[model samples]
Target chain A: MVSNTNELSHEAFLYLIRQSGIDLDTGHDKELFDYVKSVLSSLDPLRSIDVGSTEPPMMFIPAQEDV
Target chain B: MTDVNLCYASVRALSELVSKKQVSPVEIIEAHLQRISETEPVLNSFITLLADEAQEAARRAEAMINRGNHLGPLHGIPVGLKDLFNTGGVKTTSGSRIFDNYVPIEDCTVASKFRAAGAILIGKLNMHQFAYGPTGENPDYGHMHNPWDPEKIAGGSSGGSGSAAASGQCTITMGSDTGGSVRIPSSFCGIVGLKPTYGLVSRNGLTPLSWCLDHPGPMVRTVEDAALTMNVISGFDPKDVASARVNIPDYTENLNKSIQGLRVGIVKEFFDAPLDAEVESIVRKAISHIESMGAEIHEVSMSMFEQSQAISGTILMCEAAAYHRELLKDHAEELYAPVRLRLESGLLITAADYLKAQQARALFNTSVNALYQTVDVLVGPSQPITAPTLLAQSVEINGTRVGTTAAVTQYSRPYNITGTPAITVPCGFSASGMPVGLQIAGKAFDESTVLQVAHAYESTTDWHLKHPDIAS
Candidate 1:
């Protein structure tokens, strides 16, 4: 659950960005970090909703499966 | 008819004229070309206008019809495709400078369908870069201007399609709706935008916004025109994995049918959300009109509607980021800034967050399905407000200032998540003279009913007949 509505810590933000594998320009990290935090914050309310055992609805059937 | 009147004529009217030999295809194409030339300065609707090619095609259509080999309704009808649709031998920019030179060798499925229907391709309409934002502000190409007032925005990602159809630059334009892209512009521009059920229309040739959410639909001046376009485009395509194998109906066959016993639901959350008082009043009156037409109106509660934005945003961000990961890494600076930032933000979404959002989506769909059992369709305002001024950061609705993106998309995103058929028809105009939209959503693959209700409402009201003065 995305319980935290607050922005991510600066270090955690950097770590995530590092883990993303996309090279970052250090100069714009502040703005980029804030943007990412806002996006996460937007999804925070979603975490509180109990989806229970519902599947992700991601389905993929190979071409060979056709009747 | 005068050039302007001819330009503003509906596809049905033009089709009759073409089929009856009262008007040549060349005349129809020329009339629209003339209209486009007059309005292009103000609308900036087309990224690539295929003037010479359209004229040539019109001539060929004229020859075929004269020889008694007439194609049905869409034959010789002028249409514009949002730049994301792949047109063989023509540039498909997706409204970004990064693809300013990209041309596909083969037509996308929809484009080929339009061609098979004998429709004339006037040009590629402009859009929000890569179909990213709701407002048609593209730094790569110029921002799309509203037909009602040149100063306000034409709603985006399908902004160009919206403007083109509204301004009479094209009889029918296609827009891809991920989260309100088609309906948003349709409402803002005073046209009909129909987003068919998730798999009803194929996305084989369209550039992906969010594969799971992307829907290619028709943005036209009338409800019947949208139905006509659907008749041509809706079906299974082996190339599109998401395409449904369901039996496709002739959408126009029952378009004029009665909705006497139709059960229309009004989601309480639609009004309870941050909505403009005028927009609310207009939509309420629209529902009452539907009731007056022998339809039963019920108030249904779908509290999960509130979670639509969060759910759709997460999935779209992840999908779009994954699709453009290489572009973000290499040509990052070339993308429109807002789109760039949005793509980067997606890279930050955790796998848990993505999966959680999807899980929430499954539940959300279940809740929506349960509500559908209670009613045949849900009715709401297509947007909270009329078109905002170009690049306005926020719009105040009911004394609350909300971010523009959130406000524009608030009511339109729920159907995208459900992947159901939804449409926006011109209900009324705001006091400021901008158009207001009445959105109607139906059960999955129920576009016929949705179109029926919208056509009934549209025929009862003169809203669709009022063209922007700019077109004149």
Candidate 2:
């Protein structure tokens, strides 16, 4: 049986790397994880958004003023 | 003898004879079945032999030919499918104990395509469990041994397809690559394996390893054979969202296209690293030959090439876990040891981390956009070393031990991340006498140049003509 879908640990994540066949002597596992995590942590690609009652999803039939 | 000549002959040649009535499909299928019965005992490359089905199909093909009904270009040719690829009524174990009893209700996209083209499937080839590892060391199936040396690993997850194709059990075999599954085995087995552009082949009835990374492609003893198989398997699928909507070009039409004026890039960084002395020599020789043939070989550096691999690891593991989560819950006891461990570990990764990895993938893709601008294609040593020993954890190189997956797939996986097409064909062998591979990669969706270069190399060398010494 399975449980606990949340709160995964860093240690656990690293363990998965070894099991995946990427656990090379070059410490590529650590390098790969750290690099990917750092990139993901730094990229702030999107911010919060809100939808209004008057508006539909953008890019509809040419809007006169908002075009 | 296995008629060693016909084992590696092009499918076009075989089809020509079949059409001319010089040879019937019955005779061709009998020869292959006989060869498989003799060699497969030593190689242990097959999971099941569909001899009865194959002969019946061949008889039907003969009937059609007698009535002047030509099914298609691949009419009357025999082929093999990797076990993970679903074939209705045949056991589709994926080389794991988890699905040992499972059979599919529908044939996979490729299998149906082969049938439509009149290609008869001989059997299901063994593979790494759930297509996870590189060594093709399946605990349940007891690993497919390399045909060149019984003690060595055949290389995987396409190991059996490679071994069977190289040994003439089937002239063409289909195997999936999550990371170098097709190309690595092809390199180790000394055959041609082309992992088409990620979405070029339909994924519909094949079991998923990593949805984004798994690519099903053909493995055959020659470049033209691989191209012929590719022509049949490549096209858009309404069922596969990732399937390329682009046109599937006639790969054979350009097989002899002069690469004379083509600009080929040789990664300068790749040469600096110590490789098998013999492998390094063969690759350098291939580069020179291609250069002397009027193609310009420019030594280029893409530091980003080295980092694209990290993105591959992240993306593959996360998606793999997502796919295997339910199986891990219900049948953890049923899964094979290593594959079970692999999937269980994936279940523990958080979704945020998985999403983060996908974000990093976008960045890595951006980083490699500059490489295609400078070079028409990139060429390098397929595997840093030749095939290693079966059941062996690692191999010693230059007084340092490298893990099997690292040494075997280092050059092949980076391209998988970028979704660029790559092909590996035998170039030469090592001093200890194992096959070596020259890997050629082209800009995304440009399999033509990749095939052309491989064909050109095959035309110039006799390495592709050699077969594993499986006769005993």
Q: Which predicted model would earn the best lDDT?
A: 1
Model 1 chain B is weakest, by summed lDDT over 10 consecutive residues, at: B1-10
Model 2 regions lying over 4 Å from their true place = A1-67, B1-5
lDDT of 1 by residue, B1-472 (tens): 4343678888888988889898898999898998899999999999999999999999999999999999999999998999999999999999988899999999999999999999999999999999999999888779999999989999988999999999999999999999999999999999999999999899998999899999999999999999889999899999998999999888987778898989999999988899999988999999999999999999999889888999999999999999999898888878887898899889888888889999999999989999988799999899999999999999998889999999999888999999999999999998999999999999999888899999989999899999898843
C-alpha positional error of residue B218 in candidate 1 after TM-score superposition, expressed in Å: 0.1
Q: What is the interface RMSD of each candidate, in Å?
A: 1.9, 11.1
Provide per-model DockQ scores.
Answer: 0.68, 0.06
Candidate 2 matches the true fold with a TM-score of 0.87
Error of 2 at B9 (Å): 2.3
For residues B187-291, what per-residue lDDT tens digits would candidate 2 score against the true structure? Answer: 999899998888899999999999888899999888888888888988998778678899888998889989888988998867765477777888899889888
Q: Over the stretch A28-47, how does candidate 2's per-residue lDDT look in tens digits? A: 44544454343333222210
True contacts kept of 2: 0.02
